[model samples]
Target: MIALVDMNSYFASIEQLDRPEWRGRPLGVTNGRTGTCIITASYEARACGIRTGMRVREARALAPDFIQVPARPYRYAQVSSSIMAALESITPDIEIFSVDEAFLDLTACQKLYRCPVEVVARKIKHCVFEASGLLCSVGVSGDKTTAKWAAKQQKPNGLTIVEPWRVAERLAPVPVTELCGISTGIGRFLAQHGVYLCGDMKQIPISVLAGRFGNLGRRIWLMAQGLDPEPLHREVKAPKTIGHGKVMPPDTRDRQEVDRYLMHMCEKVATRLRRHQLQAGVFSIGLNTRRGWVARKLKTVHPTADSDPLIALARFFLENWWDGVGVHQVHVAALDPHPQACQGELFAPDHARRDRVLAVMDAVNQRYGEFALCRAPLVKRSDMPNVIAPSWKPAGYRNTLEP
Candidate 1:
C-alpha cells in the first residue's frame, strides 16, 4: 500500500501552534513583504472566504479581524524535519513530497506491524502530531496518485482508504481536477469531452487521450481508473535550475530600487548554487512590467556561483532589456549547473581566495541567519524574500529553509 500524509493549513497551522492564543482564530500567513499576498489561510479564515493568493486588503474586507502572520521558513523547516523523522521510524521506503507532505510505501513493512494499513495510518497521524503538535490527513491506496487523491477527500485531520477493488466505485464521484496531475485546463478539456468525473473518464478511449495530451494522456487515463503506475520517488534529484523572484511593491520602478531587489535575488540564487556545490553555466533574468514579461538568457564562458558575477549579469539584462516602465516583479535564475569541482579557476590563487571568502560568508549566514552578513546594497534592506518554495524538503539540497 501507498500512503500520503498531508499537513493541513501548514504555514498558518504552524503559526497557531507557536502562538497558542491564535488557536481557532482566523489567521493568514503572508510572504513577509509589503503588498504580499496570502500564502496560506487557516481553516477559520477559509470559513470566512479568505484563501491563498488573496491580497491582505481582500482578506481584511472579508474579515476585518483576520489575523495576519508573517511566515517563518526556518521555524516551519524545523517542525518539518521533526515530523519527517517520525515518519522515517515507520518505514524507510518513503518519499519526502514537500515540506508538509510525504509518501510511504508499506508493501514490505505492513506485515512487520501485524496490522491493517488503516491502523498504520492512524499510527502515522499520532506520530506526526506528537512530533510537531499539528494535524495532517492521510490517504492510503495502491498507488501514489490514488493515495494523494484519497488524502484530500477530507481536510484538517482526515483518514481515507481505498482498497484496490474499491478504487473505481469510491472515486466515481471525485472530479477529474481533484487528481494530483490534473489542472483546471485539463479538467476543462476533459469536461468538454463529457468526462467530468473519475468514473466518466473511463468512457474515454486511451488512444484519444494520448492523441490529445500525448504521453501525459495515458497517465491521466490510468489515474482515472485508480491504476496509476507511477512509483514513489524515494531519491532526491538535483534541481534543474535554482532561482528566486519577488513581486515588487506597487509602483516600484526606480532604477536603484530595482537594482537592490535584483542584487538580492542574485545573491539568493548564488547562495543556493554554492549550497549544492554547483556553478551555473547559464544565467537568466526576467522582469514583469506594464507591457508583459521581458526576459534574457545568456551562456557564461565559465561556470560561476559567485554573487558578484550573477548581479553583474542581471544588471546587464536590466540595462538592455528593460523599458522605462513601472516594474511589477523581478526574477533571477541560475541554470545548466556543473559541479564546483569542474571549475578550473579554483586553481588560481585569487579565485581561491574569493571562494574562501564566499564560503565563510555562507557559513556565517547559515549559522546565524539569512543575510546576517550580506552585500553593502542589502545592508539596510528589510524586505528579503522569505517565501518557502513548495518543493522544500527536510534534507538534501532542497532544504533551503535551514537557517
Candidate 2:
C-alpha cells in the first residue's frame, strides 16, 4: 500500500497557525501587495469564490470581506519539516510529490500494523496537527496515483481508503484531468469526443486513445483502469537541467550591466550544483533582447560545477551571439550534469583555490543572508533584482527529504 500525505491550504494554513483569530475567515496570502494575485487562499476564502491566481483587488470585488496575509516561504518550510520528521517514525519510503505532498510506500508494513490503514492515516494526521499545528489529508491505496486522487477527493484533514478492488468505482466520477498523465488539454480533447469522466474514458479503445495523444494516450488508458507501471523513486531526483532566468525592465540598453547579471546567475547555478553533488558539461545562455528573445548555447570540457568555468563559458557565449540590442534578459543553465562529477584538482592552479574560496563564501552567505558579501565588480545596488512569487524565499529548503 502507499499513503499520500497532502497538507491542507498549505501557505494560508501557516498564517492561521500563527494567528489564531484568522481561523474560519475568508483569507488569502498574496504575491506582492494589495492589487496582485492571491498565491494561496484558505478554504474560507475559497468558499467566498477567491482562488489562486485571482488578482487581490478583483478577488475583493468578488468577495469583499477577504482577509489577507503575505506569503511566507520560511514559515511554510518550517511546518513541512516538522511534519516530515514526525512521519519518519512510521516509514522512510517517502517520495516527495510536491512541496506540500509526499507518497509513502507501505507495502512491507501491512502485516505489522494491526489497525486498518485508514486508522493509521488518521493517527498520522493527528500527530502532524499536534506537532506542527497544521492539518493535512492522507490517502491509503494500492498505488501512488490512486492514493493521490483519493486524498484530494476529501481535503483539510480528510482520509480515504482505496483498496485494489475499489479503484474503478471510486474513480468513476473523477474527471479525466484528475488522472495521472492526462493534462487539461488532453481532458478537453477527450470531452470533445464525448468522454468527460474517467468512467466514460475507460471504455475508449486503446488504439483510439493512442492515435489521439500518441504515447500519452496509452498511459491515460491504463490509468482509467486503475493501473500505472511507473515506480516511485525515493532518491533525490537529478535535476533534468539547472537554469536561472529573470525578466528585464522595459527599454534597457546597458551591456556591462547585463553581463553582470549573467555572471550572478552562473554563480547561483554552480552553487546549486555543488550542493547536489553533481556537475554539468553543457552551457546554455539565453538573452531576450528588445527585438525578440535570442538564445545561445555552448558546450565545454567535462561536467563541472565550478563558477569560474561556467563564467568563462558564458563570456564566450556573449562574445559570439550578442548582437547588442542592449540585451534585456540573461540566463545561465547547466545541462546533462552527472552524479559524482566532483573533479576538483588539489595541485591545480588558481581554479582550485577559487573553488575553495567560493565554498567559504557560500557558507558565509547562507549563515548571514544571501547578500552578506560580494566581489567588487557586481556590488552595485541595481544588481539585486527584487522578485516576488508563490515561493522562492529564504526558508523554502527546511523540509526533510522523506527518506
Candidate 3:
C-alpha cells in the first residue's frame, strides 16, 4: 500500500502556528500588501471564499475581517523539514511529492509495524502532529494517484483507504480533473467527448483515448481504473527545467528597475541549477508587458551554472525585445540539461577556473544562507523574489523546502 500524506493549508497553518491569535481567523499569505493576490489561504479564509489567486481587496470584501501576512520562506522551510523527518520515521521508502505532500510505501512496513496499514497511517498522522504542530491527511491505496485523490477527499485532517476493488466505486462521482494528471485542458477535451466523471472515463475505449491524447491517453485510462504502475522512487526525479517569475509591485516602464529584476531572477535560476548539480544548455527570458507577452530563448554551446552569463543573456533579450511598454512581470527559465552532465574541464584554464569560483560561491551561500556571496546588484532586497514553490530543491539532496 502507498500512503500519500499531505499537510493541510501549509503556509496559512504555519502563520497560525507562529501567531496563536491568527488561528481560526480568515488569513492569507501574500507577497505584497493590501491589494495583492494571495499565494495561500487558510481553511478559515477558504470558508470565507478567499482563494489562492484572489486579490486581498476582493478577499476582504468577502470577509471584512480578513488578515493577510507576508510569506517567509525560511520559516516555512523549517516546518517542512520537521514534517519530512516525521514521515521518514514511518518508512524509508518515501518519495517527497512536494513541500506539502509525500508518498510512503507501506507494503512491507505494515508487517514490521505489526498492524494494518490504516492503524499505521493513524500513528504517522499523530507523529507528524506531535513533531510539527501540523495536521495531515493520509490516503492509502494501491497506487499513488488514487492515494492522492483519497487524501484530498477531506480537509484539515482526513484519512481514507481505497483498496483496489473499491477504487472505481469510491471515485465514481469525483470529477475527472480530481486525478493528478488531468489539467483544465485535458478535462475540457474529455468533456467534449462526453466523459465528465471519474467512472465515465473507464467507459471510453482505450484505442480512442490513445488516438486522441497519444501516450497521455493510456495514463488517463489507467487513472480512471485507479491504477499506476509507477513506484515511489526513493530518489526524486531530476527537474526538466528551473524557473522563477515575479509580478512587479507596480507595473512600470522603468528600464533600470526592470534590469534589476532580471538580475535577481538570474541569480535565483543559476543558484538552483548549481544546487541540483546541473547546468543549463539553454536559457529564456520573458515579460508580460502592456503590449502583450514577449519572450526570447538562446542555446549555449557550453552548459553553465554561473549567474553572470544568464543575467547577460536576460539583459540582451530585454534590450532587444522589449518595446518600452509597461511591464507587469519578469521571468527567467533555464532548460534541458543532459542527465549525465555536471561541472566540466577540471584543468581547462579560464573556463574551469570560472566554474570553480561559482562552486565556491554556491558553497558559501548554502552554508551561510542563500545569496550570502551574491553579486552587489543581486544583493538581498526586501522586494526581491523569494518564493519557493513545492517543486524547488537543491542538488545533492533528495527532499527539502529550503530555497
Candidate 4:
C-alpha cells in the first residue's frame, strides 16, 4: 500500500505553532510586502475566505482583522526535517514530493506494525504531531496517484483510505483537476470533450486519448480508473532547474532596482548550483510585467556555476525584453546541467582566474554570510527577499540539523 501525507497549511501552520498569539487566529504568511500574495493561510483565515496566492490587499478586503506574518523558510525547513525523520522511522521507502508532502510504501510499514492500515496511519500522524506539533492528512491506497488524491479529501487532520475495491466509488465524483498532472488547461481540454469527473474518464477510448496526449493520455486514463502502476520512487529526483523570484512592490519599474534584484537572485541560484556540485549549461531570466510575463533563455557553450556571467546574461536579456512594461517581478534560473568539462580559450586566461576568484568568494561567504563579497550593485541591498522555492532543501540551510 502507498501512504501519501500532506501537511496542513504548512507555512501558516508553522507560524501559528511557533507563536502562541497566532494560534487559532485568522493569520497568513507572506513574503513581507503588502502587494505580494499570501504564500499560505491558516485554517481560521481560510474560513474567512483567505487563500494562498491571494494578494494581501484582497485578503484584507475580505477580512479586515486578518493578521499577516512574514515567511521564515529556515524555520519551516527545520520543522519539515523533523517530520521527515519521524516518517523515516516508519519506513525507509519515503518519497518527499515537496516540503509539505511525502509518500511512503506502507506495505512494509504495515507488516512491521502488524496492525490495521488505519491504525498504522494514525500512528504516523501521532508521530508527526509529537515531533513538530503539526497536523497532516494521510491517504492510503494501492497506488500513488489514488493515495495522493485521497489525502486531499480531508483538511487540517484527516485520514482517508481508498481500498482497492472502493477506488472508483470514492474518486469518481471528484473533479478531473484533482488528479495528478491535470492542469487547469488540461482539465478544460478534458471537460470540453465530456470528461469532467474522475468516473467520466473511463468512457474515453485509450486510443483516442493517446492520439490527443500521447503517453500522458494513457496515464490520465489509468488515473481515472483509480489505478497508478507507477511505483513509489525510492530516490528523490534531482531538480531539472533551480530558480527564485520575488514579487516587486506595486507600480515600481525602475530598471536599476530590477537589476539589483536580478543580480541578487543570480547570486542565490549560483550558490545553490555550486552547493549541489552542479553546473548549468542554460540560463534564463524572467520578468513579470503589468501586461504579461516574458522569459529569455540562452544556452552557453561552456558549463559554469559562476554568478557574474549569469548576472551579466540576465541583464542582457532584461534590457532587450523590457518594452517599457511596468515590471512587477524578477526571476533567474539555472537549467539543464552540463555534463561536459569546462571549456577554456587560450587567449582568455582570465577565465580560470575568474573561476578561482568566484570559488574564493563563495568560501568567504560560506564562512561569513551570503552576499558578503557580493557585487557592487548588491552591496547596499538589504531588501533582497530571502524566499525559498518549492525545490528548496533543508540541507541548503546554513545550520541544518538534518541527519
Task: Estimate every model's Cα lDDT from 0 to 1.
Answer: 0.86, 0.73, 0.80, 0.79
Residues 1-403 of candidate 3 have per-residue lDDT tens digits of: 8999989999899999989999999999986453387999999999988899998889999999999898887777677777777777888888877777888998887668997767888998998899888899999998989999989888779998899888878888889888998999999989988889988976778787789888888878788778776778766566777787877755679888789888877888777777766677798889988777798887655677778888888878877888788888888888775443544456533666777888898889889977788777665443533666667432243333322
**Which structure among the candidates has the greatest TM-score?**
1
**Collision count of model 1:** 0
> By TM-score, how accurate is candidate 4?
0.86
Model 3 residue runs over 4 Å out of place are 32-35, 249-251, 276-281, 299-303, 336-364, 372-374, 379-385, 393-403
Error of 3 at 396 (Å): 3.8
lDDT of each residue in 86-171, candidate 4, tens digit only: 89888889887778888898776665688888998898899889989999999999898999988988876999988988898888
lDDT of 2 by residue, 13-84 (tens): 888878999988888987435326687899988888889988888778877788768666556666666776
**Residue ranges of candidate 4 with Cα displaced over 4 Å:** 33-36, 249-253, 286-302, 315-325, 339-357, 382-384, 393-403
Point out where model 2 deviates above 4 Å. Answer: 32-35, 63-68, 210-215, 250-257, 288-292, 300-304, 312-330, 339-349, 376-403
| Cα deviation of 238, candidate 4, in Å | 4.4
> Which candidate number has the best lDDT?
1
Q: Could you estimate the TM-score for every candidate? A: 0.94, 0.83, 0.86, 0.86
lDDT of 1 by residue, 333-355 (tens): 88787687653764443577898
lDDT of 4 at 310: 88
Clash-forming residue pairs, model 3 = 275-395, 276-395
